[model samples]
Structures are given as structure tokens and as C-alpha cells.
Target chain A: MRDTYQEQLDELASGLADMCDDVARAMARATTALLEADLQLAEQVISEDIKIDDVRAAAEHRAFGLLALQAPVATDLRVVVAAIHGAGDIERMGDLALHVAQAARRRHPQTVLPDEVKSYFAEMGRVGVELAEKAGRVIRTRDLDAANELEADDDAVDDIHQHMFTVLMDRNWTHGVSAAVDVALLARFYERYADHAVAVARRIVYVVTGQMPGPLAV
Target chain B: MRDTYQEQLDELASGLADMCDDVARAMARATTALLEADLQLAEQVISEDIKIDDVRAAAEHRAFGLLALQAPVATDLRVVVAAIHGAGDIERMGDLALHVAQAARRRHPQTVLPDEVKSYFAEMGRVGVELAEKAGRVIRTRDLDAANELEADDDAVDDIHQHMFTVLMDRNWTHGVSAAVDVALLARFYERYADHAVAVARRIVYVVTGQMPGPLAV
Candidate 1:
């Protein structure tokens, strides 16, 4: 019985790691779709997001089920609670990626951005995909060092986000209203996608350290 | 002992209701500050948001304590878990309100928006504060009807959000890039503020109806 409980706990952790992988791949593909104007790839990312959600839902079900059936307490209980919340953070990251994919799909054959903004988004996509991959490793290993490193990566994303505004707010900006709106929303989706990654890392830190951290910047 | 547990649970519920009130008031003041360029009011809202955070933190601590000490199960267990998550949703709403206040402060004596965009934000503020109040009542009463009604109120916010884009995208739009960015971010703060209220209401619906609902639109 004890072995079964431990196995279930391990399964929950592995499930979250897998969800992180899905979200990372989705983000990378969504970025590629956006930059390359690949409608088929954009659609693929959108559809794959559903699988991410299903994985998250299954993880949460398992976490809650363990709580109910195993009646875990103390450390075990905290692990379950953290898994549930962390799964939510991961799920939200997946949704953010989906938003990126949808943004790409909305433009279809048309490019989503002017030349000036495209490069920033391309960089954001690269950084976001890299962070998602790191998040997967941190969750799987509970590496405190990696968890802390996630924030620095997030700062890089924030810098890109701020640079996006600098370009938009520049006196030379000639993109007009429609392009402006797209840039604003798309920048936000990527920034928020990175924020959720940091948030997931924070939750894992809490689970491992048993220190309830402040809420992630939303 | 059971009565004691019940009383603690009641206290948790009341704590969340009070947070709803704080968040609602902060949002109202933030809106006033934004429209009138009231730096003092904006500062007040920003400072008071700390109290809101304190309340939510306490509530989570108590709920976790109940879980550990009471060893609650079944419906009782669900209530505690829901309260923890619900408190988080409300706390995030508070953060959104704080973001609104911060935006107003960031602009200082100068208004954050051009005169053209002011009325739309004014309307969004009114709807947001009213929904926060309604959300309080829904959480306190667990009124499924009111909980469901919150979605309609959120639609009003969404409409305002869409209108913001329409204004931004209009050929006649005269607001420069800086003002446009402010409007975009402010509109989103209000829109997301309403989304969190709906998310909270959904949590209450789940607690009351014992049927897990779909995730709120992120």
C-alpha cells in the first residue's frame, strides 16, 4: 500500500513534467507558425493545446484522487496541493500558447506583424520556448537552482516585452492602429506565457522548500 | 469539535467576503483616480491593496490549518480546498485593481488617457466595481443564480474591452502611441478584473453544485 502511494505521487510529478513538454513544444511551433506564416502548423499547435489541457485535467484528477483516497498528510499533502496548483499554472501557460497560435491563425496567409515587430516576437518565441523546456526540467528534478534560474529567463522575456513597447511607442512607429493592436496583444500573450512559466517554477519551489512564496506577478 | 471546525470554516468564508469588498472599493477609487487625475486617491488605493493581500494570506493559512488539523474529508474537504482556490482568485482580482491604481499613478497629474478614451474606461470602472460587489454577495450567499448572472456582467466588461479596440483601431483615432499603449493596458486590466470575478463565481458554483465547470476564458 505504501509503495502504491509513493508510485502515485511519482506519477503525478511525471504527469506535470509531460505537460510542460507539451506546452514548450506548442509555444515553439506557435512561434514558428507566426514567423513563417504557416497556417497548417498554427492549426496543429491549436489542436495540440487540447491535448495539453487533457493532460492537465488528468494530473489534477490524480492529485485530488490521491488526496481523497490516500488521505495524505504533512509533506505528502503539501505535495498534492502544490501539484494541483502547479498543474493549473502549467495549464494556463498552455492556454497562453494557444492564444499565440490563434493569433497566428487569425492572420492566415497575411503576416501577423510588420517587419520591425516580427524580430522582437521571434526573439520572444525563442526565449519562451527555452524557458518552457527549463521549467520541465525543474519540475521533474525539483532543482532549486533551476527554479531560481527561471526568474532570470523571465527577466529576459520582460526585456523583450518592454522593447516591444519601445518600438510601438517610438516616434517613428508607422504601423498605425491595426498593427499596433496586434503587437500589443501578441506581446502580452508571450509576456504572460513567460510569467506563467515563472509562476510554475515558484510553485515547485514552494513544494520543495515548504515555504509559501508570494503570488506570482500576473 | 465539529462545531469548532464549522465555525472556523465560517470565518474563512467571511474573510473572503471582506476581501471582495476591499477589492471593489480599490477598483472604484482607482477609476476615479484615473479619470480625475487624483494622485492621492490612486496612492490610497495602492497602499490599501496590501491589506487585501494580508487578508487573503490569512485565509489561506487558516484553510491549510483546517485541512491539517481537522483531517476533513468529503464535502468538508472540498469546502476547504475551494476556499483556498477561491481566495486566490479574489486576491488576483485585488492585484488587478492594484494594477489599475498603479497605471493611474504612473501617469501622475496627467491623465492616463486622451479625452477620447476616458468615457470608455469610466464605464468599465463602473461595471467592474458593481460586479465586484455582486461577486461578494454571490460568494457569501453561494447564490447560483447570482453566480451565473456574473457571466452576463462580465460580458458587459468584454463589450467595453472590444469597444476599446474599436476605438484604437478606428481611422479617426488621434491618440498617439504612448496613450494607445496606456489605453490598451488599462482596458485589459478592467477586462481581466472582471474575468477573475467570474472565475471566483465559478469556484463558488463548483462548491455549491459539486459539478466542476470548465475553466474561465484566460
Candidate 2:
């Protein structure tokens, strides 16, 4: 019976890891939709919302079942809680990707942007995607260092966010108000994506430190 | 020893409850500042950001502590977890208040709509404030019906949000590009305020139902 219980726990963790992989991949696909202007991909993300939601529910049920039967103590309990929070955060990130896809539908075809702005978004998207990947890695390995690294990346994201705001406001550009709005929201989506990555990092800290460490500003 | 432990738990609950009260009031005050263009109130909301941050940290710590030591089983465990989730949502709501207040600084001394708009705003504000107030009541009373009521009230907020958007987009309005930005963002603040209230309501449902509920329509 004890061996069976141990195997069950292992299975639960494996299942959770798989679900995180799917979430990370789903997010990457949504961003792909944005950059490629692919309606099929947007529809894919929208449909996958329920799938992510299902994984979250399954993970929670597994966690609760383990706790109910085995009565997980201390760090194990925290692990369950951390997984729950991480699950919820990633689901929200998925929703953001869907929002970006929806907004992209309204945007002018062919990613027309001033060269600098285009580069800014490319860099931001690259980092945001990297952070999502890193979050999945941290979940799999519980690598404290990888999570900490994501914290430093948020600063770069914030710098881009601030710069984009300046471009939106500067009178010299005569940036169309609608274009400004779209870019502003997109920049914001990236920055917020970065911030949520930081949050995942902080959540990892909570697991390691047994308390939530300070915000990822450091 | 039992008394001391219980006291600690009670104190933590009250501190969290206080944060809830602060957030609800801050949201109501933001609407007042927007309508009245009261810069002083706006400044107050902005300044309170750090204090709100402090409240959130304190609340999360207390919740974590309760979890770590008590290992609260079943529904009690759900309540503390719900508190953490609700606290995070309300904190964002408080941040949205600042957004509204900041937007107010850019608006004209008075809104240009006919007298009917103000009446609409008044009714909308009342519903929003009531919905938010009920979030706290759900916390204290653990009343699922009140939680459902709050979710229902959010529909009225959505109604007002749509109306405001229509007014802003109307060709007859003399509002310029900047005003349009303020209107869009202000509407966002209200929509998000209502969103947080619905989130709290959802949490309340989970606390009572022992299963997370479906998303409430805006």
C-alpha cells in the first residue's frame, strides 16, 4: 500500500509537469498567431482555454486527493499550493495571449511599424516567450536559479514598456491615435506578461523560502 | 496556548478584512474623484499605493502562516486560499482606482454629457460600490447567496461600461484624441473594478461550493 501511494504521488507530479508543458506551448502558439496574423491559431488558443481550465481542475483534484489520503505535511503541502497558484497564473497568461490575438485581428495587416517600434516589440516578444519557457522549466525542475533569472528579465521588459509609452505620447511622431492605442495596449500586454513571469519567479521563491520573498524588482 | 493561537488567527483575519475595506473605499473614492475632478482625492489614492502594498503583503503572510501551521483541512483551507486570491484581485482593483484618478487629472473640469450621464454614473457607481461592499460581506459571513448577488450586480456595471463607451465614440462629442484616451481608460478602470468584484464573488462561491465556479459574464 505504501509503495502504491508513492507511485501515485509520482504520477501526479508527472501529470502536472505535462500540463505545464502544454500551457507553455499554447502561449507560444498564441504569440505566433499574433506575429503571423493567423486566424487558425487564434481560434486554437480560444478553444484551448477549456483544455487549460480542465488541466487546472485535474491538478487541483489530484493535489486534494493526495492531501486527503496521505495528509501531506510541510513542504509537500506548500508544493501543492504553489502548483495551484502557478496553474492559475499560467491560465491567465493564456487568456492574455487570446486577447492579443483578438486585438491583432483589428490591426492593420502586415506588421507595419516604425522600425524602432518593430524592433522593440520583437525583443519584448522574444523575452516574454523565453520567460514563459523558463517558467515551465522551473516547474519541472524546481530550479531556483532559473526563476531568479526571470526576475532580472522583467527590468528589460519594463524599459521597453516605458520607451513605448514615450513614443505614444511624443507630439513629433503624429502617431495615429488608434495606432498609439493598439501599440500601447500591446506593449502593456508584453510588460504585463513579463510581470506575470516575475510573479511565477516569486512563486518559486515562495516554494524555496517557505514564504513569498519580496517582489522580483531585484 | 490555544487562546494565543486563535488570537493570532483572528488578528490576521481582521487585518485582511481591513484591507478589503480599504480597497472597496478606494474604488468608490476614485469614481468620486473622476466625477468631481478632485485632485486631492486622486493624490490620496496614489499615495496609498504603498500602504495597499503593505496590506497585501501582510495579508498574504498571515494567510501563509495559517496554512503552514494549521494545515487547515478541507473548507477552512479553501477559505484562506480564497482570501489570498481575493486579496490579490482587490489589490489590482485598488491599482485601477489610481489609474482612474490619474486619468482624471487630464480631463476637462467637467464632463460634457447632458445631465443624464451624471445620473447614469451615480446609479452605476452605487451598483459597483455595492457589489464591492458585498465582497467583504462574503468574506465575513461566508454567504454564497450574497456572492451570487454581487455577480448579478456586475451585469449592471457592464451595462454602464457599454453605455459609456458608446457615448465616447459618438461623432457628436467634441472630445479630442486625449479625451478619447481618458474615456477608454476610465471605462477600463470601471470595468476592471467590476471584474475584481466578480472575482471575489467567484472565490466566495468556491469557498462554499468546494469547487471553483465558472466565469461570470462581465
Candidate 3:
């Protein structure tokens, strides 16, 4: 029974890693769709979000089942609980990715990003994908070193977010109100996506250290 | 022993309700701070968010305890799990409220919203508080009817959100990109706060009816 319980916990961790992999792909594709104006890719990313949800639901089911049947205590209990909460954060990261895809789809045939901030978004997208991939690694390995790196990764996203604002607020910015709104919203989506990724990493760190990480700086 | 378990479950529910109450108050105060540009009120809301976090941590601890000790099954298991997840959503709602407060505080003596959309934000503030209060009732009563009402309540928030966008997109909007960015971000904060409240209600409805609601229309 103890061996079976340990196996189930391993499965829960793997399921979360798989969900993170899916989310990472979605973020990558969503950014590509945004930059290249690929509506098909955007739609694909949006539709596949359901798969991430399914993975999360399964993880929650397994964790709850373990709680009900095994009644894991101490470290085991913490792992199961963190699995449930970490799955939630991952699921939300998927939602944020979908938002990015939808924004790309809604602005189809026209680039959602104004030309001025195009390169900035490209850099943001790169860092966003890197963060999601790193998040997957942290969940799979629970390496405190890798988990701690997410903060710096998210800080890069924030810097770009701040830069996006600076560009919008610049006197040279000629984009109309509509484009400005689009740009602002897009930057926010990316920034928030990074935040959720960091939150997931922090949850893993908490499970390892038993020191509760405070809320992400939203 | 069964009676003791039942009492623990009751405590979990009460703790969650108390957390909801604190979050509701934070949202209300954050909105007032924004509307009045009351830095003190904003700062108070910002600081009080930590208290909400503490409430959530305690609630999670209680729920985890029940899960480990009593090994609740069936409906009991579902309720405990929901408490954990629901507390998370409520805590996030508090974070969103904190974001609102931070926006107001950052703007300091200068008002964040442009003059044209002032009344619109006022309406949003009123609706935000009403939604949070109603959310508390839905959680406390577990009334499917009350829970279902949150979707329509969120619709009201979405309407204001759309109106804000329309105003921003209007050619008549003379506010520079800075004010426009501020307004866009503020609108998003309220919109997401409403979405989280609706999500909490949906979780209750799920526990009651077992019908899963799809993602929020972000």
C-alpha cells in the first residue's frame, strides 16, 4: 500500500509536468501566431487548452483519491496538497496562454502589436517560452535551484512589460487609442502568464523547503 | 469521533466564509480608494491583503488537517477539496483588489482615470462590491440559485469593461497613452476580480450539482 501511494504521487508530479509542457507549447505557438498573424495556429492553441484542463482535473482526482484512501501525513500530505494547488496554478497559466491566442485571433490579418513594440514583444515571447519550459523542469525535478531561477525569469518579463509601457507613453508613439489598448492588454497577458509560472515554481519550492512562499507580486 | 469530524468540517466552512468576508471588504475598500484617490485607504487595503493571505493559510491548514485525520469520503471529501480551491480563488480576488489599490497609490495626487470615464469606474466600483457581497452569500448558503446569479452579475462587470474599452477606443479620447494604459489596467483588475468571484460561485455550484462550468469569458 505504501509503494502504491508513492507511485500515485509520482504520477501526480508527472501529470503536472505534462500539463506544463502543453502550456509551454501553447505559449510558444500563441506568440508565433501573434507575431506572424497566423490565425490557424492561434485557433489551435485556444482549442487545445481543454487538454491542459483535462490533465489538471486528472491530477486533482488522483490527489484527492490519495487523500481519501491513503490519508498521507507529514511530507506525503504536503506533497498531495501541493499537487492540487500547483495543478491549479498550471491550469491558470494555460488560461493566460489562451487569452494570448484569442487576442491574436481577434486581430487576425492585422498584427495585434503595433510596429514600435514588435521587437520588445518578440523578446518577451522568447522569455515567456523559456520561463514555461523552466517551470516544467522545476515541477518535474523539484530542484530548488531551478525553481529559484523562475523569479529572475519573471523579472525579465516584468522589465519588458515596463518597457512596453514606456513605449506607449512616449511622445513619439503615434498608435491610435485602439492599438494602444491592444498593446497594453497584450503586455499584461504576457506579464501575468509569467507570474503564474513563477507561482507554480514557488509552490514546488514550498513543498521542498516546507517554507511557505508568499503570494506572487501581481 | 464522527461528530468531531463533522465539527472540523463546519470549522473549515466557517473559516472560508470569514476569508470571503475579508476579501469582499478589501475589494470594496480598494474601489473606494481608487475613486477617491485616497492614498490612505489604498494603503490600508494593500496592507490588509496580507491578513487575507493569513486567513487563507489557516483555512488550508484546517482543510488539510481534516483530510489527513478524518479521511473524509464522498461529499465530505469534495467539500474539503473545494474549500482548499475556493480559498485560493478568494485569495486571488484579494490580490486583484490589492492591485487596484496599488494602482491608485502609484498615481498619488493625480487621478488615474480620465474625466470622461469617471462615472463608468464609479459604476464598476459599486458593482464590484455588490458582486463580492453576493459571492459571500452564495458560499455561505450554497444556494445554486445564488451561485448561478453570479454569472449575470459578472455580465454586469463585463458590460462596464466593454464600455471602458469603447471609451478608450473612441477618437474623442484625448487622454495620452499613460492615462489610457492606467485606465486599461484598472478596468482589467475589476473585470478579473468579478471573474474570480464568479469562479468561486461556480465551484460551489459544481459541488452541489456536479456540473462543471467552462472557463470565464476573459
Candidate 4:
């Protein structure tokens, strides 16, 4: 019974790692949809978000079952609780990616990113995917160093977010108010996607080290 | 020992109720600060947010202790787990309010909302505070009717959010890109604040009914 319980716990962790990969793919495709005005890709991302949510529900259900049946104590208890928390954050990351995809679909037949700011989003998308992948690795390996790297990558995403705002507010910007709003919101989606990835990594750190680094920068 | 465990569980619920009140007050003050350009009030909201976080930490610690020492199962276990999840959502509500306060401070003495949009924000603020208070009531009483009402109030917030966007995107919108960006972000903060409040209420319903509310509308 104890060995089977251990496997359940292991499965929960790997399940979350897989979720991180799912959201990474969703974000990468959403970015492509936004850049290329590919309505087909955007629709695919929007429809497929359910798979991520299903994975989250399964992870949470498994964690709940473990807690109820095994009543794990000490480190094991923390692992289960952290799994619940990590699943929520990862699910939210998928939702953010879905929002990005929806934005792409909303502007179908007309690309969302103005040329001047497209490169910033491209970089944000690349870094955001990298952060999600690193988060997956961190969950699977419990490597504290790898977990720490997510923070730096998140910072890079924030920098690009700010730079995008600069381009939007620049005197040369010709995009009207509607387009500016779209860009602002899209940038926000990428920034929050990275933040959630970092949040997942932080949960893993807490599970392993028994210390929750610090309160996330507001 | 059993009696003490019951009391600890009760305390966790009340702690979360108090947190709802704290965030409600913070959101109220944040709205005032934004509308009045009151730098002092904005700063108060910003600094006082730590108190909310502290309350959250205490609540989680108590819940964890219950799980570890009491090893509660069935309904008792759900209560403790729901407390953990509810505490997280409430803490995020405080953060969203803090973001509103920060937006207010960023444009101190120069109101964030222009003349035409002031009334819309005023309505959003009123509805947002009402939702938080109702959420607190639902937490303390487990009143499913009140919990259901939160969904309606959240809809009102969403409506105002859409209205604000309409104003921003109107052909006559004279606010330049910077101000438009500020309004867009501020609207998002209020909308998200209301959403988190509703999330807390939904957790209460789940604890009572044993069914999670249909996944939050996106």
C-alpha cells in the first residue's frame, strides 16, 4: 500500500510537469497565431484548452485522494498540498495562453501585433515558453538552481513588457486607440503567463526546501 | 483534543472572513484614492497590504497544522483544504486592490479616470465592495444563495469593464495612448478584483455542496 501511495505521489508530480508542457505549447501556438493572423491555429489553441483543465482536475483529484486516504504527514503532506497549489497556478497559465489565442482570433484576417512591437512579443513568447519548460524540469527534478532560473526569465519577460509599452506610447506610434488597447492587453497576457510559470516553480521550491522563497513581487 | 481541533477549524473560517473585510476596505479606499487623487490613502492601501498577507499566512499555517496533527478526513478535511484554497484567493484579491492603489499613486494629483469615465469607475467600485462584503457573509454563514448572487455582481463588473473599453475606443476618445493604457490596466484590476472575490465565494459553496462551481467562466 505504501509503495503504491508513493507511486501516486510521483504520478502527481509528473502530471504537473506535463501540464507545464501543455501550456507552453499553447502559448507558443498562440504567439504564432497572433503574429501570423492564423485563425486556424488560434481556434485550435482555444478549443484545446480543455485538455489542460482536464489534466489539472485529475491532478487535484489525485492529491485530494492521497490526503484523504493516506493522510500523509511531514514532507509528504507538503508535497500533496503543493501539488494542489501548483495545479491551480498551472491551470491559470493555460488560461492566460487561451486569452492570447482568443485575442488572435478576435483580430483574425488582421494581425494583432503592429510591426514595430512584433519583435518584443516574439521575444516574450520565446522566453515565456522557456520559462514554462524550465518550470516543468524544476518540478520533475526538484533542482533548486533550475527553479531559481525561472525568476530571471520572468524578469526578462517583464522588461520586454515594459519595452512594448514604450513603443505603444512613442510619438511615432500610429496605431489608433483600439490597437493600442489590444497591444497593452496582449502584452499583459504574456507578462502574466510568465508570472504563473514562475509561481509554479516557487511552489516546487517550497515543497523541496520547506521555505517559500518570499512573497512574489506584487 | 477533538474540541480544540474543531475550534481551530472555526478560527480558520473566521480568519478568512476577516480577510474578506480587510480587502473590501482596501478596495474601497483604493477606489477613493484613485478618484480623489489622494496620495495618502493610496499609500495606506499599498503598505497595509502586508497585513492581509500576514493573515493569510496564519490561516494557512493553522489549516496545515490541522491536516498534520488532526489528520482530518471527509468533511473536516474538505473544510481545511477549502480554507487553504480560499485564503489564497482572498490574498490575491488584496493584491489586485493593491494594484489599483498603485495605479492611483502613479498618477497622483492627476486623476487616473478622465471626466467621462469617472462615473463608470465609481459604479465598478461600489459593486466591487458590495461583492466582497457579500463574499464575507457567505464565508461566515455558508449561504449558497448569497454565493450565487456574487456571480451576478461579477457580471455587473464585467459589464462596466466592457463599457470602459467602449469609451476608450470611441472615435472621440481624446486621451492619448498613455492615459488610455492607464485606464485599460485600471479597468482590468477592478475586473480581476471582483473575479477573485467571486472565487472565494465559490469555494465556500464547494465546501458546503461537495461540488466545485462550474469552472469559472474562463
- Tens-digit lDDT string for candidate 1 (A1-218): 35599999999988898888889999999998988889999999888877887887789778767877788877777778778777877888888888888888988888888987788999999989888888889888989899888899889999999888888878898877677778887898899889888878887888788885666666
Candidate 3 per-residue lDDT over residues B129-168, each given as its tens digit: 7777777787778898887788988898899998888888
The reply for model 4, stretches above 4 Å from the true place, is A1-3, B1-3
Best by TM-score: 4
Residue B40 in model 2: lDDT: 79
Pairs of residues at least 3 apart in sequence or in different chains that clash in candidate 3: none
On the 0 to 100 scale, the lDDT of residue A127 in model 2 is 81
Write model 4 residue lDDT over A63-82, tens digit each, in one string.
88999999999889888888
lDDT of 2 at A165: 70
- Chain B TM-scores per candidate, in order, are 0.95, 0.87, 0.94, 0.97
Off by over 4 Å in 3: A1-3, B1-3, B214-218
For B1-218, candidate 4 gives per-residue lDDT tens digits of 35588788889889999999999999999999999999999999999999999999899889888989998988788888888888888898899889989989988889988888888888899999999899899989999999999999999999999988888988889988888988998899889989988888888888898888988545
Q: lDDT (0-100) at residue A173 of candidate 2?
A: 54
Q: Candidate 1 falls in which docking quality class?
A: medium
Clashes of each: 0, 0, 0, 0
Sort every candidate by TM-score, greatest first. Answer: 4, 1, 3, 2
Pairs in steric clash, model 4: none
Q: What are the Cα lDDT values of the candidates?
A: 0.84, 0.69, 0.84, 0.90
- Of the two candidates 3 and 4, the one with more favorable DockQ, higher being better, is 4
**What local lDDT score does residue B47 receive in model 3, on the 0 to 100 scale?**
86
lDDT of 3 at A96: 84
Give a tens-digit lDDT track for model 1, residues B1-218: 34598899888887887888889999999999999989999999889888887898798789878877787777677777777777777888888888888988988878898998788889999999988888888878989999888899899999989898888878788877778778888899899889888878887888787776776557
lDDT of 2 by residue, B6-121 (tens): 56556655665666678778777777777787777777877887788878778777776777677667776677777777777777777877777666555536642234356666
